[model samples]
Target: MTEIVIETRSGTLAGIGEAGLTRFLGIPYASAARFEAPGPVAAWQGTRAADRFGRQCPQQFGGKVRRDVLESETYGEDCLYLNVFRPEGGSVGPKPVMVWIHGGAFLAGGANAYDASRLAREGDIIVVTINYRIGVLGFVNFADALGLPAIPSNIGLRDQIAALEWVRDTIADFGGDPGKVTICGQSAGSMSVSLLMLSPRARGLFHGAVMQSGAVSLIHDRERSIRDARRYAEALKLDQSRLQRLKTMDIADLMRAQAIVGKQLKNAIPAAPWYDGDVLPASFDEAVATPTAPVPLLAGATRDEVRLFDLMPGDILPTKWDDLKGLLRDQFGPEQTARILATYPRSRKGRIALGSDLTFVMPTRHFAERHARGNPTWFYRFDYAHPLVGAAHGLDLTMFWPFSGLKMALVRGGPDKGRRAELGQRMRSHVAHFVRHGDPGDIWPRYEAESRKVRIYDLADSFAANPEAERYAAWAGRDVEPGRGK
Candidate 1:
């Protein structure tokens, strides 16, 4: 085993060099007090071991503990850290960099959940995975509700920006090109990517972006944020006027309160990034209409994005015709609901199809159409499905990181390891090409409103022109309220 030591802006990190890649894990980018904005890490006196993973930001992983929770035994408030993976030998020229943000409904995941060694080795690019605060401590806008006008909003996003800033300033020492950075994520992390695109603070941090199964529609407004925070405070049995007590409360007490409020809200994860008028603009539609940064984008969704919700222990999915109609009425009103119902059948499969299109497919297509007008963009649909789960919400992650072993068993299925590996290589190749070059090569054509061409990834990958045009037309110009769809 070879040990490598490199100097960063914060300190000297000792990492491992093997398999033609150098990995430095758990390096702090910033530090912060609870609910406060993050600040740069002070320089350390001596070399710090980056061999073991750092503590994950405090979170509750539903009933079952996730891999991230098991990997890192420690969890606490001071959890702003990032990991770096680059080619082993220093290249003559700087390689492209890919920074990944994880997804856990803005509640549960961390940087340790991902292993980017395959991407770094195969793509010959530097990969960085980061941890940011989540849940009430990270989001929960308290500026106006608590009368504490000085409290910072969107501390999670601030942490992400600080990590990006660290990458821009020090990535060169690890053989990465800071100017050629690509930020990508899935689910809530994907929402963060879109929000970052609209954020002035994250303006020049990355050159390109990739979003999977999420868009700007998930962001909450100030009014909703205040309501959620007040609800959380009430769940804790704390006086709303005495908000200072929350800052010093036990972390376990806060998490229990969060769980209670989350149950009351009928949401598994209650808190998320919100439009603060500073980091994010007032209107997502308006922001997308007139984009500030015309960066290259690779955006797409799985064919049955919402089917994964069926596996959860709840009545979340619509099982019957009446349930489906009720949901449509709530989302699109009676007039549009009648039209949507007429377009599809009244069965379980029909409901799943409608819910999938309404929540994930349509939003992604709309964003791709608007973004492609001024930027180099590519759109795709993942059609590979498991026998039981189908092409669900997180199936794309298995393909993006194929060598994840048993972590991907739920999606990959049995006796088809070879086929899964082939598909994964194909998808990763396209991503690697897009990261190094601005476009996704000549095989996949650029998406335009006139053509509406989309790459379909399945057993046999092919290009199609608006395959679901009729279904998409049903949702034309219709805007669902934020947080209602998910």
Candidate 2:
């Protein structure tokens, strides 16, 4: 087996690797007990086996996540680890590093789904993916449980910070630059990026950030989060004094509680990462709207983000249009609804566009342009459809990382195989170049107010500075609910 050594705060750890890239997996960054506080990783002697992936945080099973990832064990309250990827042979001085934070709505997800081999090999960028605590163990604040002070809510985010500290200290030995680290994530990972921008604990961990489809609009005030916490405690059937007992409960019980709380909350409020008046201070919207912290940002969204997930049955597409019309009237009232209907019209195209625009693309561009005033911001719209998926959510990641072979299943015996493959090469090139250098190159210009430039990636033709001002303006100040794109 090929092997390499890196010195961590604990000790020197030797990680075995393969021909393509050197990957260090299951490296502990922080240690936390169930319902306890996380501080730092425990010091170890000699070396640890980082050859295998660490445990992923627990979540509800049976979904779109890969089977390889699903087969991984669930480590509740004990899921703080990061994986490092380095090219086979590289100089150590200052290689670009991209630290990835996985997204699962702050409740269910892990980092193992992403394979950084291609990014490390092709992009020549060292990639580190980390796992943080999720659900109640990571969140769900029970006030003064067992005579402790207000429990830290967003322990998951703190895990990310700890992993970055590990990266800062150890990545140099793995042929990565500690100073040139760039943090990039999609969906919940993007939300984490936005929240990290506001967190004092996360400052200086990374220099630049790329937020893809970060819908930070769905957050609650501190009072509201605390209120939700009380309800979660009630569901757990734990008295204020015996809240410590939760730590001793079975891991399955914890998962059940998480699912229950998740279902109950639904769209009421996010159960994790509250505006704790300390960790998060205020909601992300408030932080970005008022020009709080200044950080370089590249944020964007896919064109048909919602069509990928159809909550309703396919048979009801016809009758659903009537309900959509009524929803339009209820949201905007008679006159604006009429105007909206006139503007978008009632059709299959209208329905898909409205959902996709409001749910993802609009919020994405709005967050970018609004923050552009105070920070160096670049925006992109991924109109590049996968022919079948039609530019859906999480599609671009397969092209960027080129792992797990999931996206390959979307295509079959087709004469257009080589053309799609070539276009995918271009996508990887663009993303890798962006991660290595702060710019996405001449094909995608730096977004500025004077010229709301955008890079459109598609199979037919690709170009930069293509603005979606109409979509952006319509959903700019809307309430971020369903059908608000109308």
Candidate that scores best on TM-score: 1
Give the per-residue lDDT of model 1 (tens digit) for 124-216. 789999999998788877675666766788889989999999989999888789999999889888888888888989999999998888887
Error of 1 at 478 (Å): 3.6
lDDT of 2: 0.66
What are the candidates' C-alpha RMSDs? 2.7, 4.5
Query: What tens-digit string does per-residue lDDT give for candidate 2 at 1-486?
Result: 687777766877778778868788888887887655567777898878788888887655322223333234645445677888887765545678889988765666788888888767877788899898766667666653333464566667777777888888878777678888878888778878777777777788788888887656544555555665666666678775665576677666655555555455432322566665566765544555544246677888877666655543222111245554665577657775565555555676777777666556766676677777777777777776756657777776655555444335453112224665565677656556767777666556677777888777666545455354554444444534331111
Clashing pairs in 1: none
Clashing pairs in 2: none
Error of 2 at 408 (Å): 5.0
How many clashing pairs does model 2 include? 0
Candidate lDDT (C-alpha), each: 0.78, 0.66
